[model samples]
Structures are given as C-alpha cells and as structure tokens.
Target: MKQVLTIAGSDSGGGAGIQADIKTFQELDVFGTSVITAVTAQNTRGVIDVAPVPIENIEKQLQAVGDDFDIAAVKTGMLFDAVTIRTVADSIKHYNWQRLVVDPVMIAKGGASLLKEEAKDSLIKHLLPLATLVTPNIPEAEALSGIQIYNEQTRRMAAEQILKSGAQGVLIKGGHGADPDFTEDFYLDQHGGSLVLRSSRIQTKHTHGTGCTFSAALAAEFAKGKSIEEAFLTAKQFIQSAIEHSLNIGAGHGPTNHSAYRHYAQKEMIRYVH
Candidate 1:
C-alpha cells in the first residue's frame, strides 16, 4: 500500500484534523501517518480551546516520519501559527516531498479561528509556493487572493490570484456558496488548465470534516499515481458519498461518514466541465 502523511491538528471529536485524514486514507486503501501540529478541545458544538504543539516537538515529529517512511504524498491542515507553517514548509523542503496538498484550514465549522490571524502571510509566503494543490473554500480564497468572489468571473479571478502566489493549482470549494441546490468547485492549474466540478448539495448539518476528508482522499489518490484531474474527480465523489450518508451522532453539526464512499461508490455522481 502507498504511504501518505498528514500534518495537522488533533480533533478531540475525531471528526476533523488528523483523525479525519487517517480515516480517509484508510478508506482509500493507503497507509496513513500523521504529525499533530495542534490539539483542540472541540466537539460537535464548538471548539473550546486549542494548544499548538511546541515548535521543537513539531520538527521532531516530522523528522521521525520522514526518516522512517517512504511517503508518497503529504497534506497539511489546521496549522495554528506562523511558526508551525514555517516548520512544516521547511520539513517538506528538506525531505523533498513533491506531492503536497495544502488544505488551508482557517476556521472551524462553528466559527472558531483554527489558523491565527497573523499566520496568513506566513502561509502565503512559505507554504503556498510548495503546494502541489491548495484547497480553499470561498472565504479562504478571498483571504488569500485579496479578491472578493461574488460570481463565477470573480471566482476565477481569485483562483488566478492564488496561482500567482506560487501554488501550482487551486480548488476554490463551493460548499459555502449561496447556491441552494448545487455546489460548484472551480479548479485552476499553473498550466492554464481548469475544471469546474458540480454536485447536488446534500442538505445536512453533518459536514464536520468535509475539507479534511476531501484533501486526504486527494493525497491518497496522488500517492497511487493518479493524474491531477483524476484525483480531483475521485476526491469529489468520495466527499459527496461521505456527506450523502452523513452520521448524525452529535447534537450540533455531526461528521460525514468516513466509510460511506466504499458502500455508495456506485450510487454517487458528480458532473464536471473541462
């Protein structure tokens, strides 16, 4: 099995962060390894507190993983501060890990700031350039690109601005969009290739780990040597299935079913335009 690594925070609820990444990797038949950058006291309701892992310990964990595993791909999420972002970026450079999926996790579902307000610049400067693909939701894309996305034209402009920041590709997720019936994600690469992926929105409050899960699945697919377009399509299908069969275990927003893709693979569908 191919090995992939997730450098992210630990979610006490087991819905997002490292837990979701590992679960997604397992469902995709890849070996999952992790380096926890922060630990959050969170549950379905909201995040209570977050403690970032010390910089030294974070570096040590990365070293341990890099030394031991022949990791095929990597994904990063919920890096709380500038120091953690720089540390992760340096480690990725040292290990020469090329296939990197950056899930720019800025906020929790309940409006808690996961990434620091001051860390945004560091992420743009130190990390974005190294990313093979950067996945950001509508808000995050606005923050990164400094462009307000109000329509399809502005969305493409924002993506182009992000690509200028050095990421090879960007996927502006549409889950946070105003469209009530359908969600559309826009993908743009450095080579001028673009794809618009659309799927029927599943009405549910249980989408806690959707970003983490989708990016993790993308990394797993890349680890297995799939093309960028192929990986995005598969990851889209995976998240749709997970959300369609979401688990309603919590009182607040619950989590998407991590294992649902395998069971519903034949039933889920996503439409894309190249």
Candidate 2:
C-alpha cells in the first residue's frame, strides 16, 4: 500500500482537518499518517478555540515521519501561522518529497478563519513553490491572487495569478461560488493546459471538509502514480459523490460522507457491466 502523509491540525469534531484527510486516504486505499500542527476545539457549528503545537514538536514530528516512512505523497492543511508554514516547507524540501498537494485551507465552514492573515505570504512564498498542485476554493483563491472571482473570465484570471506563485498547477474549486445549477472548477497548469471541470451542485450544508477531502483524494491518486489530469478527475468525482451522499451528523455544517465515493464507484462499476 502507498503511504501518504497529512501535516494538518486535528479537528475534535472529526469532520475536517487531519481526521478528514486520514479518512479520505483510507477510503482511497492508501496508508494514512499525520503530523498534527494544532488542536482545534470545534464541533460542527463553529471553532471554539485553537492551540497550535510547539514549533519544535512540529519539527520533531516531521523528522520522525521523514526518517522512517517512505511517504509517497504529502498534503498539507491548517498550518496555523507563518512559523508553522515555514517549518513544514523546510521539512518538505529537506525530504525532497515531490508529489505534494497543497490545500490552501483558509477558513472554516462557520466563518472562522483557519489560516492566520499574516501567514498568507509565507504560504504563497514558501509552500506553494513545492506544491505539485494547489487546491483553493473561491474565497481562498481571491485571497491568494488578489483578484475577485465573479465569472469564468475572472476565475481564470485568479487561477492564472495563483499559478504565478510557482505551483505547477492550480485548481480553483467552485464550491463557494454563486452557481445554483453547476459548480465549475477551473484548472490551469504550467504546461498551458487548462480545463473547466463541472459538476451538478448538490444543495446541502454538509460540506465542511470538501476541500480537505478533495485534496487528500488527489494526493492518494498521485501516490498511486496517476497523472495530474487523471488525479484531478478522480478527486473531483470523489468529492462530488461524497457531497451527494453527505452526512447530517451535526447541527451546523456537517461533513461530506468519506466512504460514499467507494460505494458510488462500486455501484457504477456494477451498472456499467450489466
């Protein structure tokens, strides 16, 4: 089995962050390991508190994982501050781990900020250059690129701006868009390849971990040696299925069903054969 690593915060609700990443990795048939950057006191409703792990401890965790596990791919989420982001970036360089998926986790479902405002520069300057793919939702894309995305033209512009930050590819997720009929994600790569991936919008509030899950699925596919285009398609399919069968476990924004993708795939396979 391919081993994948997630360097992220821990969500007490088990709906997002490392919990969701690990669950997605497992559902995708990859071995999941984690280095928790912080611990959040959050439920489905909102984040109550956050305690960032010490920088030294974070370094030690990365060292331990880098020293032992043959991590095939890595996805990072919720590196709270500039220091944490720098540490993770340095570790990624030290290990020379390539197949990296950077999920620019900026905000929570209930309007809580996940990434520090001051650390945005650190993320773009340090971590993004090491990313094989950078996945950002609409709001995050706007924040990163300094371009407001209102339509397809603006969306493409924002993606292009983000691509300039050194990531090989940029996937701007449309989950946060105003589209009521279809969600259209824009993808742009350094090789001049661009695609508009569209999916029917699932009208549900259980999308707490959609970004994390999508990026994690992408990392798992990359670990399995899938091309960026193939991995991008699979990740989109995985998130769509997960959202279509979303779970209503919390009072506020719940989580997408992590196992729904496999079940959906099985049913599709059976249908295709018959």
Candidate 3:
C-alpha cells in the first residue's frame, strides 16, 4: 500500500485536522502517518482550547516515520505557531521529501483561531516552496496573497500569486465565495495554466472540516501515483459525496462522512463486474 504523512493539529472533534486527514488516506487505500503539532479540546459545538505539542516532539514524530518509510506525500493543516512551523519545516527540508501538499488552515469552523498570527511569514518562507500543491480556501487565499478574491477573475489572479509565492501548483477553493452554482475550485499549474472544477453545491449546515478533508484526499490520491489535476478532481468528488452524506450529529458545523468511499468502492466494483 502507498504511504502518506499528515502533519497537523489533532481535533478531538474528529471532524477536521489529523483525524479527518487519516480517514481520507484510509479511504484512498493509503497507510496514514501523522505528527501532531497541536491538540484541541473540541467537540461538535466548537474548539474550546488548543495546546501545542512541543517542538521537539513534533520533530521526533516526523523523523520517526520519515526515517523508516518512503513517505510518498505529506500534507499539513494547522501548525499552531511560528516555532512549530519552523520545526516541521526543518524536518521536511532535512528529509528532502517530495510530493508535499500544504493546506493553509487559518481558522476553525466555529470561529476559533487555529494558526497564530506570527506564524504566517515562516510558513510562506520555509514551508510553502517545498509544496507540490498548496490548497487554500478563499479567505486563506486573500490572507496569503493580500488580494480580495471577489469573483472568478480575482480568484484566478490570486491563484497566480499563490503559485508564484513558491508552490508548484495552487488550488484555490471557492467555498467562501457566494457563487450560485457551486464552489468554483481553481487550479493553477506550474506552467501558468488553470482548471476550474464545478460541483453541485450541497446545501447543508454540516460543512465543517471540508477543506482539510479535500486537501488530505488530494494528497492521498497523489500518493497513489495520480497526476496533480487528477488528484484534485478525485478529492473534489470525495468531498462532495462526503458532504451529501454528512450526518446531522452536531449542534454547530458537523463532520463529513469520510467513510462514504467504502460504499462507493463496493458499489462501483459491483456495477463493473455485473
């Protein structure tokens, strides 16, 4: 089986961050490894408090896995702060691991701050250039590019800027924009080309952890040897189906059904062999 590593915070809520990332990897039939940067006391309601794991522990976790396994791809979520970002960045550079995907998770679904204001520069300088693909939603795109992406044109512009900032590819998720049809996800390639993917927008309150799940699935798909664009589309469909089947369990934003892929894989095989 393929192996993928997700370096991010832990959500006790099991919706976003490492929890969701592991589920994505498993759905794609990849072995998942993780290095926790922060731990959150979160549930269905909201994230209550976050305690960042020590920088040394974070480094050890990365070293432990990276030393033993051929990590096909790596994805990051919330780094928590500057020191933690630096720690993770150093490990990645030291290992020179390829196929990196950076999901710029800035805030939580319940309006809690997941990343520190002071860590933004470090992430850009140290971590982003190493990414094969950087996935950031609309608000995160605005924060990263300092440009207001109000429409498709601006979203394209933002994608260009993000790509130039260091990553080989940029996927600007349009979930934040009030687009009528669906969230128009933009993909800007290294050769200055672009692809926009549109899906049926599932209107539901349980939209939490969607970004993390999307990016993680993309990484998992890439680890399975799919092209960057293919990975993005695979992840898009995964998120869409997950959202469609998400249970109304929580009071606030609930979790996606990451396990939906099991149903899909079984059903697809049955149809193919019939």
By TM-score, who's the top model here? 1
Per-residue C-alpha lDDT of model 1 across residues 17-83, encoded as one tens digit per residue: 9999999999999999999999999999989999999999999999999999999999999999999
Candidate 2 deviant stretches above 4 angstroms: 265-274
Let me know the TM-score candidate 2 reaches against the reference structure: 0.95
Could you tell me which residue pairs clash in candidate 3? none
TM-score of each: 0.98, 0.95, 0.94
Choose 1 or 3, whichever is better by TM-score: 1
> Residue 8 error for model 2, in Å?
0.7
- In model 3, state the lDDT of residue 194: 75
Better of 2 and 3 by lDDT: 2
Residues 1-274, candidate 3, lDDT per residue (tens digit)? 9889999999998999999999989888999999999999998789899999988788889889989988889999999898988888888888887889999989887788888888888888888888999999998999898889887788888888887768898988878779666667888877877777777677888988999999999999888889866787788878878888877878888999998866754211111100
Q: Which prediction has more favorable TM-score, 2 or 3?
A: 2
lDDT tens digits, residues 100-161, model 2? 99999889888888899999999999999999999999999999999999988898889889
- What TM-score would candidate 1 get against the native? 0.98
